[model samples]
Target: METDAPGEPGPTAERDATIEIDVLVVPDCPNRQLAEERLRQALDETGLRAARLTTRTVTDGTTAARTGFTGSPTILINGRDPFAEPGAVPSLTCRMYRTQDGLDGAPAAARIREALRAAAAAGGGA
Candidate 1:
């Protein structure tokens, strides 16, 4: 990884890497928009403009299970749920994120930014 200030361009190697981010939410989930906004912010802050983002609406339990839908507003980076805890079961309920301030409906920008960086370091967030 190359060293560059926030909002600046990173190394060509990172730019060439492919990153896929998915925001999965159930119908009537209140935090969906907020989560998407925070995710976009994280991507921008981490200088990952090349990332592809997808928003999915999981409406059924079976679909949730097959898609790894842990909860509404769940974020998956490269098909891996970075925020998922071990032994977490798939559900259609609204998810709570552990933010720096406290537990909230969505993950904090800082947390998402860190996750993005960690994924990049791991070679294209795979």
Candidate 2:
């Protein structure tokens, strides 16, 4: 029987420390590219260089439901939806974000950065 040494984390603990970020989008979503770029900038700004960022394509309602994808360009941090609002529905349409500048196809850079920071703090991995 092998046990983790004192003051050393086990494999599962170390794996749980990783932050998983997913940008879910549809094939025809125009804002997908911008979302990806913004997410990258946010990751860099938040100093989460080791975080894993993945772009997943959600083609059908079933996939969306399974992926917890609210809509195209939806971002999931650590397997949780940060921008989820009450009454929001999961679909394959392009998602709209309410920014300081009004409605937009994607969330602002500051918002993405804030989400990353919040997720990191909650995960205690920052």
Clashing pairs in 1: none
- Model 1 misplaced regions, further than 4 Å: 1-17
> Candidate 2, residues 20-126: lDDT per residue as tens digits?
88889999789988888888888667666567888888989998988778888898888888888788877888889989999888889998888877776566342
lDDT agreement with native, every candidate: 0.84, 0.78
List the candidates' TM-scores in order.
0.85, 0.81
Error of 1 at 29 (Å): 1.4
Tens digit per residue, CA lDDT, model 1, 74-123: 99988888888788899999889887788898889988888888788778
Give the poorly placed runs of model 2, Cα more than 4 Å off: 1-17, 124-126
Give the Å error, residue 66, model 2: 1.8
Question: Best by lDDT, which number?
Answer: 1
Q: TM-score of model 1 relative to the true fold?
A: 0.85
User: Candidate 1, residue 109: CA error in Å?
Assistant: 0.9
